[model samples]
Target: MSETTHTAATTRASGPGRLLVAVYALFAVAATGRSTVQILTRFEEAPLAYSLSALAAAVYIAATVALARSGHTSRRVALAACTFELVGVVAVGLFTLLVPEAFPDDTVWSLFGIGYGFVPLVLPVLGLLWLGRSHPRTPDAASSAPPSHRG
Candidate 1:
């Protein structure tokens, strides 16, 4: 017959998890501020870029929220947000390369996130990697069964 037991252990705070949270937070702030500035300063000059900036802000906000939550639900949301961010960066970067005039002003993703020191380009990649690393262990693996004491 199989036996089951449970024990207590203190899991250390995840360094990558914390880093992920921080990066997401930074994006949240940057995207929000950039979008606000663009919308207020010259929205008509580049409506597509400005609108994309708003979308970028929303995605960053969602990513931050998801990373902070750190549960099944939040993980899913984070995955989605990261995927969208990657797609957005790649698509926008390519578009800007192929169609220069199409983008009269800069958005968060313009020129592969050049304005943000490429952090915007790299963040989602790191986010996805961290997400994979932080994936929840299975029940058997996560079990806290006490070590056997037989000598």
Candidate 2:
């Protein structure tokens, strides 16, 4: 890759990006676990609830993968996934609150992510903001200058 591209890629993978990736990984694990337990034990009781859990798991998995990959494409994918996650959390939260019967059994968003200390409620928003602030690297002015030719 060209130096420009390399710098861009490196900046995109900065400390905040790594931190977000870590959080995404945690969500992946939590969502996977929640869905697996719901599916194995009580799927028959509330297919919709369990299915939603599975969907949450899938979203988190996608976010984790996308964030961990470095490139323009991966950044776009990660942004979209995080946005969708935010929407899902809000919509599911409201639905759970307004129509308790809709969720015969609790899924992850049973009480606006009360079970998860609302990290599910807040993480995506933070992720989006972080993504927005991330800038690709550019050559520093000093580095861009040609070396002086002295005797």
Candidate 3:
């Protein structure tokens, strides 16, 4: 007889999350590659933008792994990364638009990810939703417990 052990190790990345992971992983690779080339060859041209790209790449990489791992700690990491990604994209987008001079060169989030079909701008939103839905409800913590008799 085969034995099956059920645990919180299972992740949402199996279903629709599979698509999410694919997207995040793709962005991670793309951003990492882009930032590395920009920073290595032309750091003086746009240090801020290149650095931001590197940060975004790191966040994407973290989020991808966390979401795919699908555990308590992993979920928290994914949530934080998604939140930061959203904030970064919005902040960078606004800054680039409000003052074009602020960014000497384009980062992954420039123009709200216009260069990447806006996937970068929208990915975090989906990730957050997936994380929320993936949250594990304790099996014996709340509803399963007997109701306490109130005085």
Candidate 4:
């Protein structure tokens, strides 16, 4: 493989990205555990909230693996994960604020991740920024693409 491809293949799980991946991994585990216990025990209490927690757990797991994975495909997957997370957290956070009665219990995105010190709110932003820096673009993509001169 070419050097550029090698560089492109370098994972976001490197250097500071390693820390990001670690945080993602931690959230994955925590969310999985929380969701599993909640669903297995009292899913009837607040199905929506518990289900959202389960969804968050899945998202976190996907993000963790995507960030840790190599190649452009993984980066794209990570990008999608981050975008979903950003939207989910924002929408859920706002929903909780506007309709407090809707939740009846907290999900990972409740109050902008207040239960998790807002990490859920900030993580996707950071992930997007990291993706911008780490994700590979082909020569035909981005500003690196050849500019056309229209006569």
Candidate 5:
């Protein structure tokens, strides 16, 4: 592949992108554990909430893997995962607030992830911003720029 394409594919996994991937991985483990215990022990207590936690876990896992890989497909997957995570957290937060009775037990996304210090709410935003900022310029765009003189 071309240098620009290679850079675009690999850039997301380097520098600040590494920290983003680490955070995503951490969330994936936390959510997975929480959801697993909730589902195995008291799924009937708050089925919707537990299920949402499971879904959040899956999204986090996907985001972590996608962000750590180098490829066009990985970039797309990461973007989609981050977008879905943002939407899910907001929707779940609102639902739990407006309908308090619907969730006797809190999930990872309840109240915009208040349980996890709001990381769930903020993580996706950060991921999206990082992705946007790290995206590589296309070759045509790069070629149109003035040459640099570093002598």
Candidate 6:
């Protein structure tokens, strides 16, 4: 890998990035467990909500894996996952609000993730910001050029 790509990958999973990855992992587990139980126990109670929870869990899992990896593809995947998550949360949040009767129970994104302390709503924003800030630095021509020698 080029230095720029390597640096981008390493920087993405270091320091605060580690914390972000950990949080994504936590959300993945939580959403997966919640959706599984809801689907198995009482899917009929709130099929849409339960299904949405499952979808959210899948997205979280993808984001966690992508963010934890080190590669250009992983970075793209992370970006897509985070963007999707943000859109999903906003759309679902609005749906639940505009049509309260549409969802018998709450999904992870209900009321902008009120159930999860708004983490779902805020996490993607953070992920996007981190990705933006951690972009690969292009090596300039001067930096790549060989040094001149004085006779």
* Candidate closest to the true structure, highest TM-score: 6
Clash pairs for candidate 1: none
C-alpha lDDT of residue 33 in model 6:
98
lDDT over C-alpha atoms for residue 86 of model 4: 96
Query: Which stretches of model 5 miss by more than 4 angstroms?
Result: 139-151
Report how far off residue 8 is in candidate 5 (Å).
Answer: 2.5
Q: Looking at model 1, report the run of 10 residues with the lowest lDDT sum.
A: 4-13
Task: Write one digit per residue (lDDT tens) for candidate 5, span 1-151.
Answer: 7787678767788888899999999999989999999999999999999999999999999999999987778889999999999999999999999998999999899999999999999999999998888787775877889999998
Candidate 6 whole-model C-alpha lDDT, 0 to 1: 0.96
Off by over 4 Å in 3: 1-11, 139-142, 146-151
Model 4 agreement with the true structure over 26-49: per-residue lDDT tens digits: 999999999999999999988999
* Model 2 CA deviation exceeding 4 Å by range: 1-5, 137-151
Per-model TM-score on C-alpha atoms? 0.81, 0.81, 0.87, 0.88, 0.90, 0.92
Best by lDDT: 6
The window of 10 residues in a row where model 5 has the poorest summed lDDT is: 1-10
Better of 2 and 6 by TM-score: 6
Error of 3 at 6 (Å): 5.4
**Superposed Cα RMSD, model 2:** 5.3
Worst 10 residues of 2 by lDDT: 4-13
What is the TM-score (0 to 1) of candidate 5? 0.90
Tell me how candidate 4 scores on lDDT.
0.89
lDDT of 6 by residue, 3-119 (tens): 888998999999999999999999999999999999999999999999999999999999999999999899999999999999999999999999989999999999899999999
User: Considering only N, C-alpha and C atoms within 3 Å, which residue pairs clash in candidate 5?
Assistant: none
lDDT of 2 by residue, 21-85 (tens): 88888888988998998899989999988998889889889888877776778778888888998
Per-residue accuracy of model 1 over 57-148 as CA lDDT, tens digit each: 99999988877773566778988999999999989988988998999988889889998898878999988887776565546643667667
- Residue 40 of model 6 has an lDDT of 100
Superposition TM-score, candidate 2 onto the true structure: 0.81
Pitting candidate 5 against candidate 6, the one with the higher TM-score is 6
